[model samples]
Target chain A: MHIGRIDESATLGDSWLHQVSPISKLLAFALVLAAVVLSWNVLVIASITLVLTAVAVSARLKGRLAFSLSAYPALFALIFAFSAATSVLGGAVIVLKAVTAALGAVIVILTTPYPYVFAPLQRVVPGIVGDALLMTYRSLFLLIEKFGNLLTAARLRAGLHAGHPVRSARATTRALGGLLLYSFDLSQRSYDIMRMRGYEGRLRVTLPRSAAPLIDAALVGGALLLAATSLLWRVGWRDLNPYSWIVLAVAALGLAAAAASTWPARGRTS
Target chain B: MSHIHIPDGVLPFWLWAAGWAIALVMVGVAGRVAGRSEARRKVPLVGVVAALMIVSMSSEIVPIAYHVNLSVIGGILLGPALAVIAAFIVEAVLAMLGHGGVTVLGLNTMVIGAEMVLGWALFHAILKVIKPTRAGIGAGIATFLTLAVTTTLVVGIVWIGGGGEAAERETGALDPSTLRFENPFEEGLFEFGLFGDGHGDEDEDAEGERYLSVGRFALVVYTLGPVGWLLEALVTAGIIGYVARVRPRMVFEGALAEEMARIPGDETGGH
Candidate 1:
């Protein structure tokens, strides 16, 4: 799922996006989501997708990983579009809407650590629920690692027979059952440890301070402008044909700048 | 299979919003039910199970193009109260990972939560008539029934969101009594000369419009869904059977504990 890679990028990357506050990134994401939801114009949706793609590139996000992740939603959107029997343009709009929204989320997730993103949400959610969210996020890495090991062991043992569906399902289920038991035990041990450590039904998390307010403000402001343009186009108050081209051109320039920044230095051979 | 794969901005605003509203209320009720001192011990279990669900959902059975939700298994182990919470956690995480629309998180939770609750109920109901050793059979039946019901629910939601106009035009606003499927393909079955009639009309008007109506969508879903359901059911049965045999307490706790105590030399009796 590239979750491991995403986590590494979010925690290790030192890009401008990684420096912005999680709240700002989330706000920008919400703005993009609103833009997608409010507008059905193919050109407008395409513009949003292009802009986000450029943003992801400029933020030093992995382009291939982002596209691969966004492809899932695109596939589902294709099914919905086909079922709706929409015109080619209408179908493109649906696909673009899905891709745009997905790309926006990828950008946010690829830049922000999950805990930092969830810290603000702790205020709105119940203490227990918030704690559970943190616990789940923490447990994911452990379980994913164990799962990978189990699959590898099974493959080595010839326990997974892909040609025989029933046999493979049986083996998979057996592995899963064992994993569930292990997880149940892990949860019990974890609860005991938490109790011993003075867990009072809540986990404390410190929100990262915003160190780049101007950049954060610029990100949110740009998102707001994009959303406003989409809403205007949706209400027929403005024709976005010219604006769409301008946005696309900006996206191209952004990509070029990102590429130039990432290009290797001329004299270094390391 | 029952989870809505509908991307963001497709379903009407009010529909998804209402889904969110109802789901929030349900989560609140579940929290209250599982908030007791005894139930408090299950809090960490909820997190673990939710993480397990996310992991399983990420892996697909490529042959069927399906992912085992494990919600039924989660329900069987965690009970309905904690399972609902787990369902919500799983859906929210998945949405953030871009597996589904963030807007449909609530709807996905409800769909999967219903599966868990229904599967649990059905498992116990079947247990009343069968031996504990056959828990696998009970779980399989429960999984199949739960999946069927939830799949129908998905189709109904899609129809409500304006994907079933052909059926609506003929039957009038979801009137199942008058609903019927029109052949999506206008050409006869043997038009290509595999069987009888080799000659077929090439006229576009005669071929008729081809679009996926609600009925047609249902047809496609039912055709493809049973294979996935059966596969999931078998896997669920196998897992439950293994767990029940090894550590029956994990599967038969709470109310079932007392029932298991009645059986002679049963290890699944007490906490």
Candidate 2:
């Protein structure tokens, strides 16, 4: 999703991926991200990227989510590569892993609405942190709107239409300062409104249906496989040690368990 | 003065995780220490401040690619504890956008939060001793110091990530104190560089040739950083002055307003 322009409708699709629970998606994303970071093998990363593409296809996402996932890392990687880098291939590996990590997160965010993502967090996380996240998530778009309006006004008044970098930055800062004050007032009022509705500190949370552990297990297992393939087979498995073998065994078992778990439970719709 | 731009997977997991864990604990502790009323204020302020940070950090300053952190201002406004929370949120959002990596969120938080804390502490401490009008000078210095520390930390982390010992040995052929400080008086404008005793080592570094050694990196950081550091400090001072004018309470964490309310005779004969 584009920064600041992420439409609510983006997460409102009825694909099976969208129907998946937020918690599961979050877990899957975490695992995949961990795996991507843990391994540095280019081929392994490539395979993970392919897997994510497959997931996107399955989810029926029409937009180019893959590009968004890879673009940030690719930009930086390109910077390093074109510079006096020791290894342009290392940059390639970084891009692949970055794409893998971003894809994992994108899949989760694209499918799950923001509210659903934070709603269950209250039950899981302590204190007002979850509620705070929910409120921030809900209000961010409106706050962004206000910020944009103020920024435009400030830019015009300051004659920032010209390519004056420092001047433009200065105007933006002042606009943000005013926006900061406005946001405080808005936040307090929102708090008051919530209080008037008999809210003490915490929002009443209705937990989404618990995701099948199997889906998360499968995602994590696939992530582990990605990690294993990248780290262990860099030059072929001819000189495999016992420790490596053990890791492979565990990863294989995890994959089996994940496959078993995703199997539809007695007439349960996917 | 300084901010991290290292993308994800560059830093080791344990290091970044530790950063996140420590930052979280600090935020929690900071909230408690701020007292109930101040804590209440922070709950809302954190979001706005985080939004400000995100907006600022998202863009670059052109050729140098350095983004104005504005975190020092955040630290000055939110204090140390809330700054951590706010910094964390900003890093998290940026992580999602891919400017920085998600895994390094905690580490990024700690670095930015430290800037906020250092700036806040330095500014307020100076405010106690100096006139209120000179608060911006204190902010400028605070901004300078914050960037200096952040630069050191960033360089140190990179060194560690690149296998510090090997890199050290590789650079040992050159003088250890290779960074020559450019005299701002003679230099038309400051530039970030390492004079490096005019030595080059072809010892095949692990981290890539484009990146410099810790010592050289420090040289580069200080060389280039100060130009922005000077500009940023001025901007920070300007922001501080403006905020103090419009809303003293916003700048001073309600201290002036609280004191005035407590005195109760400000409009009367007591003045």
Candidate 3:
């Protein structure tokens, strides 16, 4: 799953995006999402996508990995795009919308810890639901690890025979059943541990006290600018058309520059 | 598998907004119901089940392009009240992971939650006629039927949202209508492209562009859906059957507790 990779990048990165507060990032994401939804112009969406790609690059994120994660949405959107039976440009716009939205999300997730991300959400949702979301996120890594181990053990025990689909499927299902039981036991233990630690009905998640006001403002400002641009374009403001092209070109160039800067330097081999 | 994958901006605002409003209401109702029960104890279980759903949903069976939702299994284990909450969590996490759009979280949750609730109800209903040993068949039947219902739900959602005039204004295609082809027999069935050339009419003017229509979308979905449903049903059946044999109490925990208890010496009685 992309979760592990995303977790690693979020926790280990030292870029500007990594330094930005999670709440700020989320707000920015919301604004960008509003822009994407409001605008139908290909150039506007493409510009937003280009700007996001540049942001991803500036953050030193792996372009291939980010795009790969976004590819699922792109593939599904392709179907709907065709189903819409619009012009080729229209189809491209649909696909771009999906990719751009996915990329925006991937950026936020890749830069913030899961706990930090969910901390804000805990306020809006019910306590039980919020706690469950946190627990689910926490337990996913453990369960995925256990699932991998089970698959490996099944292979070693010859429980999974590639040539025998039926037998393999049966074995897989049984393993999953066992996994469910294990999960139940795990949850019971977790509950006990939480109780021991005095984890009342609600989990208290404290956001870090440290702040990055300037970076946060910049991110939000950039998001607002993007949204304003989209809205203006929708409202017959054609004056920004030439500048949109300039923005796209600059974004593409910035992305290329970021990529080149991050590329590994060649070492002389004696 | 039954979730609508139409990304963030594609769906009509009103449709998704209504979906959110309805989903919130359902979650509120479900939350209240769960709160009256052993919600504190069930919280962890809900988490584990939600995690499992996420794992299954994220893993695709490549050849068929299907993901095992495991929603029915989750429903069976978590029960309907908590299952709805789990569905919300799963959809939220999935959206963050780019599996679907964040805006459609409520709609996706409603679809998957329906599958879970319907599956759980169907399983117990079927158990009335069949022996506990044949629980796999019960689960299989429930999964298939629930999948059919939810898949139809997805089609309905698309049909309603696909009629956006904004889409027409942007794409130059009229609102989604009936499926049509310029010349089906002459072009040959195999010659049609699902992804290429946008229906083999590249040169068609904006007024004449071939509208894929919701009917065609449904045709494609129905064509590909049953295979996924059958596969998921089999997997669910095998898993449930295995669990029922080893831990009958888990399968017959809440709703069937009284019924199974009536059967003296039955392992499902949780004695």
Best by TM-score: 3
How many steric overlaps are in each model, in order?
0, 3, 0
Provide the lDDT at A224 for model 2: 63
Q: Pick the candidate with the highest DockQ.
A: 3
Per-prediction DockQ scores? Answer: 0.29, 0.12, 0.39
Question: How do these models rank on lDDT, best leading?
Answer: 3, 1, 2
lDDT of 1 by residue, A1-270 (tens): 677898998899888999999999999999989888876555567778877877887776877888888877777677667656334555666678778888888888889998887787666655656677778887788788888888778878887877876666667888888787677666766666777898877788887878899999999998998898776654431223335556556656766776676566322523
List model 3 lDDT by residue over A1-270, tens digit each.
867888999899888888888888999999999888876666678888888887887787866778888787877777767665334655776788898899899898888888888898777777778888899987898888888898889888888988988888887787787777777766766766787788778888887642678989999999999898777655432233335556566657767876676565212211
**Alpha-carbon TM-score of each model against the true structure:** 0.85, 0.74, 0.86
Question: TM-scores of the first chain across all predictions?
Answer: 0.91, 0.71, 0.88
Judging by TM-score, tell me the better candidate of 1 and 3: 3
Ranking by TM-score: 3, 1, 2
Model 2 complex DockQ against the native: 0.12
Best by lDDT: 3
* C-alpha local distance difference test of each model: 0.73, 0.58, 0.76
- Listed for every candidate in order, the interface RMSD values in angstroms are 10.6, 11.6, 7.7
Please give, for residues A57-125, the per-residue lDDT of candidate 2 as tens digits.
555564464455456555544443333123445556655666667666666666776656556534543
Worst 10 residues of 2 chain B by lDDT: B184-193
